[model samples]
Target: MSATQFFKISLKRSTIGLAPDYRAAARTLGLHRSHQTVYRPADSTTAGLILKLKELVKVENVASIPTSVEINAARKAARGYQVVEKQGAFTKI
Candidate 1:
């Protein structure tokens, strides 16, 4: 049989102060931040994890290993501002 394919699932939100079950699921998947990724074989366990944290996690198909490229790209896309300007002017000494 061919090598097992893995899915790269990320936690898109924090479980802090949320439902206990949701937080437990996130912890089980090793997700503790807004951009945490977990690699799991395409199996029932992984599917269960997805279902458990569906509201706080986002699942996507991945070829091999998990990478930050996809997550970073998503972050940039969701950003409302490209550059933040300072309110005050700079001074010289």
Candidate 2:
């Protein structure tokens, strides 16, 4: 099967109070907030976007684009019971 192509990009820095050009670049690349993960095609234009936002974003190569289900699964997995056990009542306690 043809492997699904995907590019993983994350916003590492805040665009607030930055130069207009830099902010525009980040916005153009669809990175409007911190810790934002955007999936893009594997191409030179995408690469250029990443480069432009490198100071404010991180670029990574991923196997494929993760769906909402996958993202939710990962978020669920990261919810440590011990960490938030005291914050809320247990559902099946």
Candidate 1 per-residue C-alpha lDDT over 8-75 given as tens digits, one digit per residue, 9 for 90 to 100? 78898888888888888788777878887788777888789789778878887766873579656766
RMSD of 1: 9.1
Model 2: per-residue Cα lDDT over 1-93, one tens digit each: 236466788899898898898888788778888999788888878778787777777777777787899888987765555654456665884
Q: All candidates' lDDT scores?
A: 0.77, 0.79
For model 2 the local lDDT of residue 70 reads: 80
Question: Could you tell me which 10 consecutive residues in candidate 2 have the lowest summed lDDT?
Answer: 77-86
Backbone clashes under 3 angstroms, per model = 0, 0
Model 1 ranges with Cα > 4 A deviation: 1-4, 66-93
CA shift of 80, model 1, Å:
27
